[model samples]
Structure formats: structure tokens, C-alpha cells
Target: MKQIVIIMIIASMLLFTSAAATILPPPDLETQGILLTTDVSALGIFSNNADLSWRHSSEVLDANLNLVDIVWDPETGLPVVDPETGELIEIWELQPEPPLKYDSASFEVQMATVYSEDTSAQYGEIAYSKNSMVDTKALPASMSNVENDRIITYTGLNGNRILSKENLMLSGAGTPGVPSALSTTCAQCIPPGCTCYPAFCSFVDTGSKIDMSIVSATTSGEVRNLNKIGGGDGERWPPIPSVDGPAHMSYSIRVAELSSSQPSVGYVSTYLNLENSEAGAWCVGIPSLMQELSINERKSVDGYVSLFSNLVNYESAICR
Candidate 1:
């Protein structure tokens, strides 16, 4: 009787050990987060509010001066009439009298988030940088001739002949030109005898944020057995075990437009799922799991124009 009891005890012990070996625990969870911000400001001419002016030395020319007579179609010196407005078409008008010291100006502001990702790997990598990730574009007012307008000719004080011409008749009298990294090689570098133009856009500012969390588990049936032992009470175990290894979140902001006609604004949001492999566990075989990440971004810019003296002042507000 004693021998039979011993044999039965050993068999029971073997069964219990086998059951424990077959049980697997849950996996681990890891997370990472990121945020970004940016700002931009600029000054430049506003086309809609532009004005024309003429000057000779410090003297302002008279708008009604009979400097010259011009006919758009010389063959038909007869003045043409605008069919839409029924007004005599004036081909050339004298530049603004008193030579407008200043005209229309504008201001703008901008902001954005920026980032990049590599998708070739199973658990892809994410990255961001000032030099590589972010980009900006803006438009500046260029020298333009007044349409259909021309200067004829005038006699100078010494009887020397002076020809009235579009560009030669006037010049931009706003802030002196400043060097630009985009247009020139150096900050102050300018071509000899050439005047620099004031930049339409200036200076970019940036910022960011981050948040993270992590959890871990093992591959073991004992975890499930513990739930059973606790009378099917799921709460007794770490919230459902995860088979995946870890997860990470990344954010990127981009300043898409600094000068486009379209509203200078942009926003983006997305969720990504990734795969990872796990090493074989004593209780459970090797397996693959899915990881997840979330992203959000935004950007915007506003422009304003103001006149001081005879020049236009350009300004902008940016947010990201």
C-alpha cells in the first residue's frame, strides 16, 4: 500500500510541473512622444496697393507737365475710348506729383511642425532636424514698369537732352536693400556698384514637446492560471497581457507656404501600425506582434501692410 501511494504522489507532482512549464506570461509595452513649433516674419511690397512716382534730384515732377505726347497706335494718334468705362484711354500719365515718398507695404506671420520617418525596417525609425526637415518659401516685390506708360523727353537746364523713360523716370525710395542668404552668398555681401533689395521675408523661430509611458509582461500560462485560481477574476492579472514588445509616438510640423496666394496654412494627423519579432519563450514559441504610433501637426501665417513716409512696410505673423 505504501509503495503504491508513493508512485501516485510522484505522478501527481510530474503533472503539476508539466502544466506550469506550458503556461506563458504577457509581453512588454513601451512608448515615446514628440512635439514641434515654429514662427516666421517678413516685410515687403503689397501689389494691390502699389503707387508710381517720379523724381529728378530732390525736385518732384508735376503730374500735368507736358513732358511728352505718346500714342499707343501711332498710326491712329486719335485717343481710344474704353468700351467698358467709356473713358478716353490715357496711354501715359506723369509719375505721381511730389514723388510719393512711400506707398503700399505688408507684414506676415507663420508657424509649423516638421518630421521624417524611415519605413524600410520592421519597426521603422523617426527623425527631425532644423536643417533637413523644415522648409519655407516666400515672394518679394520686384522692380516692375508701369504698364503702357512711357517718358518722352525734356530739356535740361544746360540744354542737354533728357529722355523720359519708365524705369529711369523713378526709383524705389523704401528701406535700403539688405543681404539675403537665399539670394546672396553672404549676409552683407553685395555686388560692387549694385544696390541690394530689402528682403520680403525675415527670421524663423521654432519649438517642441514630448510624453512617454512603458509596461512589461512575461510569457507564462501561470498568469492565466492565477486568474482561474482567483475565481475567474480578470482584475487580479495585469490588464490583458500584450504580446507586442513596445510602441512609440512621433510628431512633425511643416511650414508649407510662406508666400503662396493660397492661404498659408497646413495640418496633418495619422496613425501607424508596425511589426516586431520576439525571441522564443520557455512556455510559448517565438511570435510576431504589432506596435502602434499616433501623430498630429498644424501651421499658419497672416500678413499685414502699412505705409510710413512714401514706402510700404511688410510684416507677417506665424504660428505652428
Candidate 2:
């Protein structure tokens, strides 16, 4: 019962408020101070109730006796169990619980949005605020390296409506290299014996079923072959130039238009002669949105669209 009383007192400290006590009030001076025992059982009593004792001091006088100072262990709130021992002794103390750490990211976006309204004043105040930039860092130049390294590769159905690996094949002797120049023969691989017409790198809107075309034209065909993929051919191609190729290959590929709606989807359209085994205009890094549109469309609108969209997303994600 005594131990229960001590626990109840400790528990009460936790509640914000407690109901009026119906239980009897603790003993007062009129009842005389409790005489604590030497045994641990009696010490348990001091541990529970208000077992503090008082010593008469030369302070002030009460109604019938001299006023006394109620004593407690100077180090702990608890009273010592030994009644006769006058010297102060230590008692076990309880520590208050620590407060929780708050998360700032949870509120950063909302605060930033509001700050944008009144740029100078509001932003200045935010800057002066305590630890406003905690955990955030300046934009790093090497995030580009991280993004490139994080490029995810996907493998499934090559997303291209026409000229996809599924529907095209090569005609020239082995893959085109140095002296060979780039060339390919088109055939509808989807339906065996369906002779292909001309090849188109991108989409084409034809009113009816048509044959895919195949042609090859390279301005510096004999000059830009490096790494000897095409052997010591005509003038050695000049370092397989990039988009603004010093010497570019312009070819018209005939593509089948199954439907005007389901457009092809992929990356830039260009014949790749990296490996001698597979040489054709293949998409880079997983198929992109470029595969669906015509080559002209990809070069014009799609190029700008990709560039601007990437810029916007990058700014939003990192600049703030």
C-alpha cells in the first residue's frame, strides 16, 4: 500500500491536471513527525510518503513552538531514511525526460513559398532566423556526375512504332565502317517477304500501307573512321563527329505507318557504327520521347522541349 502511494505521486506529476483528491490528505505537523525505522522495509516508507523531518532553528516562532526548517538532501529532492543521523546523506533522484527533436524539412517548402512573395524583407528575415540553413548546403558542381552515374537502364519492348529493331534489317556487306560508308537495305521483318521501301529515322504520315525506304549519304564518309572499326578505308573518317558532325550522314529511311495515333517513342535518330555487328540508327540510353516524332520534329521542337524541361526541373529541385 505504501509503495503504491509513492508510485501514484510519481504518476500524478506526468498528467497535465488531476481530479480533486478523494483520498485522505497526508499527515501534518499536528500529527507529529514520522519515526523512521532502521530496516529497509521502514526505509521504503520514507521512500514513499512525505517522510521529511524538521529541525528547530533560531528563525521565527509558531503558535506553540519554534519554527523549524524542513530538511532535504541538498543534492536530491528525496529525504534521507536515517532519522537519528543529522548529517545530510544522498538519495536517489529521477531525471526529467528529454524533449523531442523537430524536423525542419517538413515546413521548409511552405515557408519558402511565402517568402517568395516579398523577396527582400521576408527573405532577409529568414536569413537572420536561427539555423535557417541547417542541414542544407550550397549547390555542388559535381551533381551532374552523380546524375549521369545514376542513369537507370531499362530493357523491355523497344518503344518505337517504325524502324524499331523488330521491323528492320541491314542489306550492305557487314556493318558499315571507315571506307565502307553507311548503308542499309529495309524489309518489313514483321511480315516475312513484305519488301521495305525507303527508311525514315522518325515518323511519317502516309494515307495507306507503304514500303520503307533505305539510302545512305555521308559528306565525309571516307574521312572520320577512328578505332579502325572500318579498317584503313578512304581517308579515315574524321573522329566520328557528333550532332553538328563536321561530316554528317543524311539518309532517308522508309518507315511503315501502321497508325497515325500510336507514334514511335525513342531518342535521337542516327546511324551508329560503334560495333561492326549492329549498325543502324539506334536510340541511346533507353528509348526516349524522340522515337515517336519525325526526325525534323525531334531536331526542332523536341530538342528544345527536352532542354527546357530538364532546366526547369533541375532548378526547382536544387536551386531552392
Candidate 3:
């Protein structure tokens, strides 16, 4: 019961994505004294009710958090900045649950969406925000970086549309990561094909984390802090290039706090759904309102994050 209580508290922190659109509340971004980022702020969730919605914050990368390692130009003795694109040659990090293998060309849309290049400033330092991450949302931070020998993957999580205690996959309960609902794939990863299309988004998870220092984007414009994940207890991962040729994208719920047993992470769409519904949340995270409808009128990761930027840039009240 104590553990469950702790998980629920953390859940409420990230309950914002599941917030009902009915009564648009003011920015409840800050909980307790923690100044949360736009991405991880607890917008809304039900009172004492478990969110059955299979959400995932699997793919969005927080610029503040993901500014992993700086890429230096040995010749210039300074950070490398793309002259034309203006993208800084820095290793921006990511936190996909199962760990989306890195790809350069394929992730172009995601790169262009979340990251921008503004070489106007020297050293390519662009202003961005910072956020906090708990390797273990349920247990204390001291428990982080420890060995977690549980279920290795969340490949079969789409069975139940409405989550209950029975179906809950706990850390050491059945899965490798905690916040069991926080799956590896963002959307309906059904079977053999196991495609997470229509809503392809993911973010960072717990356990292996990058340095939380580089919280500023060098290229300028508006570097988005995306790809926040949940279900702590993984390996200690290093900073990977933010724009690797193109890249990979996943989605999950922005865990207000990491937990060992509760469902902390979720779908990027569900994570972005701060405005009541999926489409509305999509509107919050995309680049523009104009939608390039996919198979079932679903939006792309690029579109998803732009709307999110809108929340941060234009609609400050909701996030700030």
C-alpha cells in the first residue's frame, strides 16, 4: 500500500496529459516546489483513478535535458555548428523504452521538427529550459543505477485498452522497467508486424540517463525538450547525437516522477494530450495547426511536437 501510494503521487504529477478538456485549468506545472518543464508538467488526470489510456512519453526529447554532449570542431577549438542548417554539432540524447536504434536519414522530419539552427550567435549557444529526472519514480533516487532483473521488454502491452491492477506490469512484477503501463512501443504494437504507426512517438525512460547539465540549445530558434520517458531501472546510457543523419522517434507519457511499480511513461500522443483529447493534445505538440493526415487522419511526430512548441512559445499560460 505504501508503494502504491507513492506511485499514485508520482502519477498525479504527470496526470496532465490525460487531463479532460472540460474545464481548462490554469498551468499546474509546478508541483510541490519542483519547477517542471512544459513537457513533464502535470496538466491533468482524474482524482484517484488509474488512467487506462495506453499513453506513452516514449519519443519527445527535452532540449534542456537532451543536450547530452557538445560536439567540438578540433580545428576551430569550438563547438561545431552547421553553417547552412545552423544545427549545432552536439550529441543530443534520447530515451526510447526498448531503445530505438539510431538512424540518421530516417529521423530528418523529427530532427527538423524539434531542433532548429540559428548560427547568428557565436559558440552556437541557444537559450533553453532545464528539467529534473528521477531514475526511480517509486523508490528513492538512491536505488537508481542498480540492477533490475525483471521482464526485459514491453512488446505485448496492447491487450488491455483499459488498465486495471490485474493487468498492471510492475517492476520485478513482470517487466524490466517500472510504471508497467509504460511500454516500449508508443501505439498499438499488436503482433508479428508490431507497427506503432498512426501515432509514432516516444520519449526518454528511466535508469540509464545522460548528463542533466547541458540544458541550452546552441542553434537557437526553439529547441523543444521532448522524449521524456518513464518506468525507471535500465542501463546508464551516454549522450547520442540528437540529429543522427535523420533519427528515430517514439512516444510515452511524461512521468512527473519515476516509479518502480506504477505506470509512469506512455505514448507520445497520450503524453501530448494535455488538451483533453488525442487530437487536441496533438495540436499542443505539433509545429503547426495544419494537419497532414496520415492513414487514419493521424498526425506526424513533427506535427505533434510543433503544436507542443506552440504551447511553450505562444500559449505560455497552459505550460508555464
Query: On residues 150-213, what C-alpha lDDT tens digit does candidate 1 reach at each position?
Result: 1111111222211111111111111112222222332223333122322111111111111101
Pick out the ten consecutive residues of candidate 1 with the lowest summed lDDT. Answer: 214-223
User: Top model by TM-score, which number?
Assistant: 3
At residue 286, what lDDT does model 2 achieve?
16
* Per-residue C-alpha lDDT of model 2 across residues 71-172, encoded as one tens digit per residue: 576688766666575644443323231211112110000000000000011101011111011111111222210010010111112221111111111111
Q: Model 1: how far is 291 from its true place, Å? A: 52
| Ranked candidates (lDDT, high to low) | 3, 1, 2
Query: Which residues of candidate 1, in runs, are more than 4 Å off?
Result: 1-78, 87-201, 207-320
Candidate 1 lDDT (Cα, 0 to 1)? 0.18
Please give, for residues 1-320, the per-residue lDDT of candidate 3 as tens digits.
Answer: 32221111111112122211111101112222222232211212211111111111222332222456888978888888898867666786555433333332111112112211111111211232223222212222122111211111111122211111101110100001111122223232222222211112322121111111111111111112222222232321321111101111122122222223322222222112212111123323422222222111121121111111101110110111
> How far does residue 78 in candidate 3 sit from its true spot (Å)?
22
lDDT of 3 at 69: 85
**Residue 12 lDDT in model 2?**
8
The lDDT per prediction is 0.18, 0.15, 0.21
